[model samples]
Target: MYAQVNATNSNSYIERYKAILLQHPEFTPFSWGSNTIYIDTEYTLYDVDKNGIPELIVKEDRSKYYIYSFNGTDVISSDVCYWSYDECLYEYEGNGIAIHDGGMGNMRIENVSLYSMVNNKLVWSGELMSTEECSSFDELYSFLDSLTPINDFLPITDYSHLSN
Candidate 1:
């Protein structure tokens, strides 16, 4: 299940993604070397940074997400606020900011931060509310629930059409 490319902007990260995906219709953002949660997932391409180029976003049940950005020469990865840890959940604040709520009581905390894809890597632009501040997690999901995700996920099989 591979695509044959004749010509493309080889320097473009988008082309690189197309090459990888068109070559493997079952493309997945992760391939955990050991036992891991690599199943029951979906992906989509979106211009997450408003940079006119689409980035690959992978997620499991829309709870845990992984962002893959291209910085010209390589694919950058950032799962920080996008990922979940047992009880954590993610809510995209649009732009590059990601909101994470996890734990309870003393263990409960809210992580609100802005991130950026820099030089082939994902780096924290800045922490709006540092977890070190021990900001209590909001019990009310009203605001959070009222908001919608950047979600436009699709099966890997539908992704190959991007370059065709």
Candidate 2:
């Protein structure tokens, strides 16, 4: 189940989340417009790499996400999405990560693309399928599930214990 932070405790929760981020020298607090972004219902902590340490999966909104992981000492982050139209649905598939670009446009699909995390970076595999081609969301997901990882797995300490 997903944990959703309440508005009453959001301030305290942000404070705690900020404190954790401060421990990582490479982490810079993100801001949108004039306000600072904080952990809330949009964030999910999980071991995406299957390593014991949990990675911070921050879903800034329905269309944007950022994944932060501690590579032993320094914290590293990868942009899961930058723009709303090009935003991709990300998931850990098989032994690696898969990003499904559902594409954009009102009348027709523009850019239907799929990406695999090769050495912790997104590598476009090309436009194999389009949102128009899929009959259901399940079919799109199944297609993404078929892709394989390009890099070998890197194991690290589990960070789930620090999720509190």
Candidate 3:
């Protein structure tokens, strides 16, 4: 996987993260007996608690997620979630078909959500497939934007509402 740090912050946490990534060549893709293993890396600065300074979340392969401070040095925590499923297909309006096995074509129909890291967990709560053609980043961005802010975790009035 490739890494990019914000150029504006020369001595920022992102820079350090990039430096570490560069030094540790293991972060890049490596071949193990002809089977290639990719190390997908991602970074984000978000205010999980609305504390102004953003907390960092680093994403890796196999739906693994790590939470780190913005300083980019210390790892706070990590969470892993499984990502695998199947969705049925059917015909629909405005849908196109592709020839599978060089035979009669089948149009993509049902959409199955895929998993990606959110906060520190691999969440499969977003739409993975859509009728429209778009990049995975576009879908991931839409999902990220749709996340609800964690305002109040512990409400004194009731605990039954925490059944989510």
Pick the TM-score winner.
Answer: 1
Query: In order, what lDDT does every prediction score?
Result: 0.51, 0.46, 0.36
How badly does each model clash, as a count of residue pairs? Answer: 0, 5, 0
Ranking by lDDT: 1, 2, 3
Candidate 2 lDDT for residue 76: 53
lDDT (Cα, tens digit) per residue for candidate 3, span 50-155: 3333444443443333443332333333343222211111111121111111112375332334333355333344554553445654573464345442223221
RMSD of each: 6.8, 11.8, 16.5
In order of TM-score, best first, we have 1, 2, 3
Model 1 segments more than 4 A misplaced: 1-15, 19-38, 60-66, 71-82, 85-95, 104-106, 129-147, 160-164
Candidate 3, 9: how far from true, in Å?
13
Runs off by more than 4 Å, candidate 3: 1-11, 19-39, 70-164
TM-score of each: 0.54, 0.45, 0.31
Q: What would the per-residue lDDT of candidate 1 be over residues 82-102, giving only the tens digit for each residue?
A: 444322323444555344444
Task: Point out where model 2 deviates above 4 Å.
Answer: 1-41, 83-90, 110-128, 131-164
